[model samples]
Target: MEIVTRADRPDLRETAAAVFKERWPEFVFHDEVPRRYTDRAEKYFGLFDIMVLDHGSVVAGGWGVPVPWNGAVGDLPSGYDAALVRAVEAREADIPATTLSFMAAAVGESHDKRGLATVVLQELTRRARDQGLAHVIAPLRPTWKHRYPTVPMDEYAGWTRPDGLSIDPWIRTHQRMGARVLGTAPRSMVIEGTVAEWESWTEMVFPVTGEYVIPGALNLVRIDVEQDHGVYVEENLWVQHR
Candidate 1:
């Protein structure tokens, strides 16, 4: 498969959206808040920030945004929400972007084990380097974290395999690609909605006020039945590439 940007083919918006929907179900509930900024980013940067395919089906995609950075260690935004907020601010203020922040990367189900994720990262970094950006950072939502939603992010991030690599395959991929884990973004992305909304999204019943492991949630969702609200705060790892 070949990677193509929106600049190359402006009519692939629906194709890109379909890929996102397939890979990220949670986005259905929480993307509205950040969609405005991401849409603006696409407008300003063209499809340069979006990675799709041409001539063949898109088996992988990467999404990112350019943001102003101070070139200091530990200065990246905490997570996806904060990172996107900064990106929006920079764009609105006409501040030149100094770094590229990768928000999401995914390989189609049938394309797994083909190393498409590595290819996506290489393309993103090459794009950033071509644009004269200093580095690329990611708020990585580990692929396997959803399996153990009750584990604290700090503990999960610290997990290591027998070979001394990350237990999470996704994090291990970043590490192998030369990214260093800075820390955990405890409140990377927050989704809050009514009980009815959560029920519809997860297709599960929340009868009382407490944290429940809803389907597809990266972390337990806190449901306040009396208040008719549910909140999900996802955790992610802050990885930096130099």
Candidate 2:
């Protein structure tokens, strides 16, 4: 397998999209912030987007954007949405980037457990270092948090195994590569929709006004039947690589 940037192989964009569709949940595509800025980021920072291709087939991929950062943990962007916005605004404002904020990484379903995700991350980090960025950070969405939707992010991020590794598989993966948790972004990605839209996304019924646990959601979605609205605020843990 070989890793290539979007700048190197623009034709691979469609292939990468297929991989992402298979990796993320249906509702994830409906996040308004990402839906608005993703194309612009891709247009401006194509060099930072990468794909792992196995004999011309996309097996894994990751993407991030450069942004100015203060080098203080407390000053990090609120979460994924904030990071994307900063990156775009910095570009438009002609500010030099000081850090690379990794946004998303995924391995195709057929290629799971082969370490391709690690390869994609390593490549992104290497690119950041090559660009002379000071650090690489991520708004990490814990892989197992969806199973415990009611738990607070700060509490969930603190869970560790007997070996001193994070109990969440995705967090453990980053920790294995020398990343330390910085903090939690309680309102990382806020997704809102009407009751019908929520049902369409999750294929589950929400007949009452209450917090309901749904599949593939990291937090309970609050539904208001009387108002015909539903909202889901996902929390993410911030981590930085040394």
TM-score attained by model 2: 0.97
Model 1: CA > 4 A from native: 52-55, 72-74
> Taking the tens digit of each residue's C-alpha lDDT, what string does model 2 give over 1-242?
88888778878878888888886678888889988898999999887899998998889999999999998987898899999999998999999999999999999999998988889889999989999999999999999999999999989998999999989999998999999999997778989999999999999999989999998888999999999999999899999988
Residue 156, candidate 2: how far off, in angstroms? 1.0
TM-scores, all models, native as reference: 0.92, 0.97
TM-score leader: 2
lDDT of 2: 0.91
Candidates in order: C-alpha RMSD to true structure: 1.8, 1.1
- Supply the TM-score for candidate 1: 0.92
